[model samples]
Target: MKAVLFKVGLVLCVLLSACSNSVDDSIDPETADDDLEGPISRPTSGYGVDGVYKVAELSFPNTEYPGTQVTIFYPQGTTSGRPTIFYAHPYGGEDKEYNRGLFEFIAKKGYVVVFVPYPTTDISIDHRYLTLWTGFTKAATDYPNIIDTKKVGFMGHSFGGGASIGLAYKAFTEKGWGQDGRLLFTMAPWYSYQISPAQLLNFPSNTKMVVQVYDEDKFNDHRLAIDIFKNIGIANAEKDFYYLKSSTVANYRYGTDHNLPNSRSAYDAYDYYGVYRILDALMDYSFNGNEAGKNIALGNGSTAQVTMPGYKNELMAPLEVTDNPSPKYTQSKYLFPCSSQENPRIANCN
Candidate 1:
């Protein structure tokens, strides 16, 4: 009887082991593959490609704005019909070398990047806006064969951020340039002029705007980004407000400050990993028409959703025509020299 009991126990153990194997084999192949693959990497807190294409830098005298210079970053071996981006430098930052990392990264991504340096002496807000618009127009005209004018995008930091908005307004209302689709990305945008809520509504419906805010920014707080985002009237357009959270990464000590967007001042965790990821995804989605990029921008999944632990985001859903009416403006005003009286250099007045 003892021998029979031992044999029965051994058989039961074997059957149990076989049942476990059968259950493992029954898993769906696709589900098993996904389990092995793991979650998609998020761009919110990581760096992107490091110079995929060789870059060629060229400088040209701006005929539109005398004494001003326009620098072009052309990717070598790039064929004709590439997307273009107009980058406006922040006030007191006329030297492109200060932000070389950002510019080169964008160029390596296959977009023709034009950097416009305005006169640091002249603190005229309107003049800066005009210079940016003129520089972009000139770049597009000069490199018509290389730049796809229809796929133009604008980017800027600080005062240049305000100028980007102004340029977008001109491009949409007066110039009718970015009707096909335009991208406007502003980093820590300063309030140069008193932009009314109605004026903000004038942005083109097809325009995609991304406003970035540094959480620890003392000079220009996140409120400025919120205000700008609130006033945007493009109900049918894609818009997002991103807040770069302060980093606690080991040895990465720089908080998300006002100057964090500039390569000269940005920390590696924020610049390469954080800001670069956002810019890369934006360009991919807006210019390259990559669906993955759009998902990232919208915080759907992948890099977009995987930000730092403390980072937060807000998105503006596309508005329906029946729910949100089209924007109309009777008079377009160009406010001049909107710099603060205290500093006279910074564009922020309030």
Candidate 2:
């Protein structure tokens, strides 16, 4: 979880110079193969088809929120007006190396991504939200000409998933960022310190979201993802839920627990077919506006064939809304006694 902090003033200049730009600058998106029918196909297994864009990793200490650090993954020379994603790590997880493949995939797709790391000891969900906001604000300021701030996306896993919801809530209700377009993708979202279902209803109806759940998730359970999907008030057409089932037993270091999405080996069926493929499709649909990506995500026709063997998927076709369900809050074992008294700027801290 330890990151080497770099000087903020020199970050853009030094990091961009170090990065190698391999993307073809003249490829027009309107005529790109991504706009074709069926599922958007990948030319290779590991990397993306947008050619090579050098990956730049740099860390900067957040002055607004002390003890928080922002890590950026930028694809150098990806042309102007590229979409951006703000990523939040899971609780007690700090290393960007955990999801390096996924991050690289996103950057290679011509998007800027910023990962925010917060203190695990005196953690508060509001603090995590603020940390993400700081990261987004700083990234926008540093790469104004490169990033299209209007087309923003939020992604996270586990507790970070809950944090993504909180950040989106603020953007829609308070900050007005979602007025343009916003997309959210969360996996195995934990419910600790998340906003109420009513608060979620206030998000812009235009906001698109995808909730991913692991079938054998023991830590947070798949029901958490369902609950989040049910509470999201966006139009049924704008939201989708997926339940990912692993065909084979995971014998890796993290096993099948909640870490399946970030498993180190990309060759694994769950990581490659179940996790990465779905994520790539969602990003393509949301960021690139590819219809084929949407078809794949909705599990339409033979698109489910792209999933791993034995992977079961449920698409919210007739999207039913639940009536005023009682609030269910599952406290995290990592939760410690901390409040706004310690940090006045933390939202919703008691």
Candidate 3:
């Protein structure tokens, strides 16, 4: 017993020494503070919904651009073949660091989020988006145990959002992928500004589509997304449309610019509400088989009702979500899921 104890003690001492040495080598002793905690940082706000967890980062290689990169926030502990979301960062955005807060929120909710970095200088050679799609495909193929290729959703903010629409159209129409699709929720995207009237009219409706617009957006026409939604709703195929009345209401903003990373503090509320709303729609549209897209209302004097594609006469109320019990922390108290129906517990990465 004495010999065993001594051996165990000796091994523990060696391990501790190794760890200490590693820390010494990696960190500058002069800069290191005795009070400094390690790599972990707590969230500034409370956890939102039940399935929502704090955000996390994921790194993968960019096949198109050898040294370039792509990142994702995956829900924790999700079993094999889970649904995935390809999230495109806003225009002129840097690494995943800028969107980490929002991505983390989505990731913790049992959905894998892929963030595409837009090359600021040259929009033509969007190798960043290519890399994102490629990396996502590779991850799904390589780790079928971790991803479900069948159920995939694409999303983006601003320019990223616009690009996501183009990408989705190409994927479904040109590439012949995701035939039996559900929905694409474009958060403050500019479909009307970027795509022409003909192009917008041409988009197919086999997949459900929802466009979120803030009334106060500065760039482009204010009601661009809603305008397109109306045209689509009136066009050939079946579609549903929803419009948010006030972007500045409870922890939400419509005036956010194309670059979210540079000014996260200025629009933290927008980040929270914008991301949560999109994710909520994607989750329901993809998994629940719910056709509640028509329930979104553009709050003004205009009288618009939520109606499914084929049966235009049948109107329904927008999705109703209830708030969860308050979180134990102070910062997170104001945070709430965009959809009251979202349960934060089940949404955790598990």
Q: Against the true structure, whose TM-score is highest?
A: 1
At residue 326, what lDDT does model 2 achieve? 24
Candidate 1 residue-wise lDDT, 1-350, digit = tens: 23432453354234323320122221223311111111222232223545446677777787656876799887765557577778877656677877787887777666778888875445455666767777788777777666777777888876677667767676667666655567888887655353444667776777776777665554443444455666677543376666665544333354565566555543354565556766777777776667667655645334443443222332211211111222121112111112334222233223
Q: lDDT of each model, Cα atoms only?
A: 0.59, 0.57, 0.45
Cα displacement (Å) at residue 152, model 2: 0.9
TM-score (all chains, Cα) for each model: 0.70, 0.69, 0.57
| Model 2 C-alpha RMSD to native | 10.0
Q: Which wins on TM-score, candidate 1 or candidate 3? A: 1
Give the total clashing residue pairs for model 1: 5
Q: Please provide, for model 3 over 107-157, each residue's C-alpha lDDT reduced to its tens digit, 9 standing for 90 to 100.
A: 655666776554544434345456555765666566666556556666666
Off by over 4 Å in 2: 1-51, 64-68, 178-180, 192-194, 249-255, 263-267, 300-302, 309-350
Runs in model 3 lying further than 4 Å from the true structure: 1-57, 123-132, 174-181, 190-204, 223-263, 267-270, 273-275, 290-350
- TM-score for candidate 1, please give it: 0.70
lDDT of 2: 0.57
Worst 10 residues of 2 by lDDT: 1-10
